[model samples]
Target chain A: MEEKPVRLDPWASAVKLEYDKLFRYFGIKPFQEVLPRVSQVFGDPLHLMRRGVIFGHRDYDKILEAYKSGERVALVTGFMPSGKFHFGHKMVADQIIYYQKLGFEIFIVIADAEAYAVRKLDRKKVIEIGLYEYVANLIALGLEKNKHTHIYFQTNYEKPYYRLIQMFSRKITMAEMEAIYGDLEPGKVVAALTQAADILHPQLEYFGGFKYVVVPVGADQDPHIRFTRDIADRFENELGLRRPASTYHRFQTGLDGNKMSSSRPDYTIFLSDPVDVAVRKLKRALTGGRATVEEQRRLGGVPENCTIYEFYVYHLLQDDRELARIYSECKEGRLLCGPDKQYAAELLAKFLEEHQRRLEKARDRVLDYVEPPEF
Target chain B: MEEKPVRLDPWASAVKLEYDKLFRYFGIKPFQEVLPRVSQVFGDPLHLMRRGVIFGHRDYDKILEAYKSGERVALVTGFMPSGKFHFGHKMVADQIIYYQKLGFEIFIVIADAEAYAVRKLDRKKVIEIGLYEYVANLIALGLEKNKHTHIYFQTNYEKPYYRLIQMFSRKITMAEMEAIYGDLEPGKVVAALTQAADILHPQLEYFGGFKYVVVPVGADQDPHIRFTRDIADRFENELGLRRPASTYHRFQTGLDGNKMSSSRPDYTIFLSDPVDVAVRKLKRALTGGRATVEEQRRLGGVPENCTIYEFYVYHLLQDDRELARIYSECKEGRLLCGPDKQYAAELLAKFLEEHQRRLEKARDRVLDYVEPPEF
Candidate 1:
């Protein structure tokens, strides 16, 4: 048998697949290989890394090695301010905050330029969302404001950062860019170069000298990671740039068992969603329950296919023993879907209620975190 | 007869054609239509405009009206720092200095980014040439340093200037870009957008509010002029931008009667060339004289097709009477190629000697005029 290559589109709204293909075809190492090392280097692994949510990596071991040697390391990531901040975004935020806690420098980009250019969103609306939604949520989720943490809007960054985009364009071809991002438009070309700058710029001397960089992204964003790595290689001699390490996490499944996205509001839960509205969406979520109560009790529930079980594993429940308890009960057919829905809804409602309070305060402090573009 | 559309490549060095076709095929109006108006609005016109060396225009009448009304108007132009400063670049500098004398704000861009990306020049070398060669020569040509005069490296400009590049890409398509530029690459796409930004950014609110802008370019660069005008139209509502007025000038003929370019050192003369070498090259220049002395005496020389006549008209003799005397003498076969070459060389040596003296003092003032990018 021959292995088939997989193509991933970072701009696509829905991306669902077996992630093992990333290892077999794309050379992404399984994150589990470094999970124990992460625990040894830092005090504890991020929940996402420990529980297999961060499923794969490319050179993440190098990031761990740099950290262990007491060398500087930075985590870089970006958010498109096209919609409300959802649970899928929180997965990325968790890794960022985790890295910051481990004393890694953090660089967060509000991708307002990408939203306006690629998504055709209004510039004012994009900036507004970038502030009130993305930056605010990150702050509420424990992204601290300190010298080690730097956040900026893409359109309002430093000159050298923009220079990287212009300089990187020299070595890469339109064909190579099209191979990673389908269909070439002027907007997509600029946006792709801008994204590469966003990832690799932390190492530039203008951005406080070179530091080992690691980006935490969803599996679909591996294409951008791959493209940026190539750019770093091309510029290594000219700019003293090195390829950044990256880890790919699985997407948070939607309520109906599809990909969770802010575009699909009915199936996605936002950090800002009202308590009752969120619970309503959660109660109706698809589960691993059989057609009937009797059938579920006889066949044993398939937690692997359950959205509610995924919520507990990915977000709601943090204690491994408790998550395991729920897993075995559901697997043995002792727990029913109705009670599981009610329980999961209670946990989600509690998290959102507390988060909304902090988000309200975070909204007032967005300017302290990042400066928006003047225009 | 139906007229055929003409396609132009700005990157191509050699551009030769009948100037009337520009009026017939493109919307560029004969500059002669605005010649008398230039004298009325800004006192005496530049020698280039007076002698029809600047032969075509788009919306130049609007620039005259703005100047007459005492409204803010600016002259924006750029130089690719891939080579030494030559007479072709000096022609552009004359227009910038001419506009500055009329109290028009000056915006000169050293296209270091374009040189590095499109021409693959070294970063340090590009910056060095941009500072010592481009900026120093402009200062020596009497470019004043004041609040109204702004010179910048394309890679080292402010945030909003770069923001315009990102925003302009949104409304343009690859096919539309390819129509203007022959084949598309990442470098070319980025360079095009950066060029558009360079032309239009003076009107942005971030750059001291809006001002009427005029760019003086060689005839081959009309493609960029047209593309920038289209961008200004698309961004009118969003960015409060208006189309810039522009003037088209004939390229200085090389010694061999081809396009004068720095790439052909034997034919093109650099401003920094030693007097002896410059004179030696000039002595070997092709002329429009008859094959034999008896034939030249009977049938007058073709002064219209002569490179030596072009030098007097473009640079050495600014007086209308002196230029007319040379033109008639050459046409009536009174001035032979040998003596004409000696006269032109003496004039060239004297000019280069005086210019190089000022150039030494101007080199020290380049840092005061523009800040070079730190790589």
Candidate 2:
């Protein structure tokens, strides 16, 4: 008899399933209580009904409170052109489009320098190739060419832009650099200074006055923002520029029951994946239940721990009631992995069709955002 | 006996006088050595024979060797605006004009920042007041407006101008900064860096290449340019700027045997001094001779070491042969200090006639140079 792939730890998968939920997994209190406050401030800007991808936040509640008191806040995000875009990044765009629709002015920095430095590219070709891929993909998503959204490269500007980056860095302590960057090599230390400079750049200058800046990133970058907050007041004084409210949002995983990454092609469906390819990847994706269909029907499956259900939670279903129904049905054996995968694939494929069509028409529209403000 | 005046030490005065003779009093080397070297690579851009108030040089021989071999070189100098013109400064204009006549692309920086930093002025009022004084003084001194003479403020500009100071600083050990700046305070490191940056600022960025630069400065700055040369190679490397030849000219002193400064109204004969005021100041000026008139006549005044004769050589008198005659006659007691003073005053008054007239008419021209370059 052929031995089945043994069901490894489901708790490990539960940890993975905890996308926006990871902040709760990690015990940060601010992220937990922020949604109601966010809703109070902007009245569900995206009409999100319930939070979808945002798992964690830091000081988000304070920002929301400030906003409800009629304070202005801006949002910040970043993209490093390391490789092709996939569904994981599409979710990032979806969240951005949502928040942006709610009225947050956004700063999206394309990390060409950091990307090139880390990836070890041929220096001569760095900007041309990488920037093209980034610009195209960003437009492919639902990002609008709005006045409030600034999409810029890290090094392509002068004046109020990187000028604050320089002045802010002048006040940063070396001890602080160590905390944000870890035990950095000399090159990494320089990179850390640049990174620290980046966090301060947009808020301190782009809008003249500081506003709330929300960073949508994973757990890896929390250390950087934490260090930024510690030094923000001092850097503001030294730079003679305004500071901003800021927060972060972490996301969860996809089909292959691991971190949502394209390293394993079957792990993520590309935003441009063919309808059939999308369907097959989702259909074959792992499930958390007994092997034989008869036995599975009798013994309830673990809905909270299933990767297939994670796709539905992160992507397909937004309604909390619908999600609860799906969750209960799966646990009761009324639903199965095959149907869940098919539903997610259909939603994602439909989303991709509109996205690909929008990508063609929005090329010039996205390029228009690159124009600098007169002042 | 009547209360004796509280007399200062003769030895202290003598020591100061001794040091100032070859160094301070005659800070710039004789133009004989300076101009031809400048003319070498510059290939005599200015048609006239190189000579004037902008006299004296250091390492001009090496510069000539390079210049004659068709290597380009640069020139550096400045004007300080002290409200009115002086014969003392008219000579500086003459010197700068002579160098420009010899094909040197001169960097005439108005010492506005130094004046503000040292003098402590209101920022809003300073630059305007300075440029008015500088432009009038320079044009009066007959600075050729175009054809390679680009005058700028010390406050504005980027080029090989200030960056070389930092670039070359790595080559300079702490021993150097301490020696020159004298236990530089922590807060003043930026000032020292500015000093270093200044040495190479003219060569910085995409500034057209220069092979040499000569600074026409007061003797006090010898320590700076000497340090500049010591680190020239390394400064070139760090800055990504070319290394240019440099010379430091010692500005001559006052008729009253003291350094020429704006505050010591009597010490420096203003170019705007009614000729009689200049003559009167020259009459009361200190002499490097015995107290008795007979003794001074017998010994001949110490012309080489005397501040009065130093001015004649550096300012009023241009012909080397005539200068040699005055020096020999004065030291031999053949020419009296009283008559020597009168001769210098008369000669300077005649030379400054047109410059004073120009200053009277050209104060408004200075403002034009204050705007941004059309890059």
Candidate No. with top TM-score: 1
Tens digit per residue, CA lDDT, model 2, B198-232: 55555543455545666656546666666666556
lDDT of 1 at A211: 97
Measured by DockQ, the strongest candidate is: 1
Tell how far residue A362 is off in model 2, in angstroms.
Answer: 4.7
* Candidate 1 regions with alpha-carbon error over 4 angstroms: A1-17, B1-17
Off by over 4 Å in 2: A1-29, A45-73, A81-92, A111-124, A162-240, A251-354, A360-367, A371-375, B1-322, B329-367, B372-375
Per-residue CA lDDT of model 1 for B147-228, tens digit only, reads 9999999999999999989998899999999999889999999999999999999998888889999999888899999999
Number of clashes recorded per candidate: 0, 46
What is the DockQ (computed on Cα atoms) for candidate 2?
Answer: 0.07
User: Which TM-score value belongs to model 1?
Assistant: 0.95
Query: DockQ of each model against the real complex?
Result: 0.79, 0.07
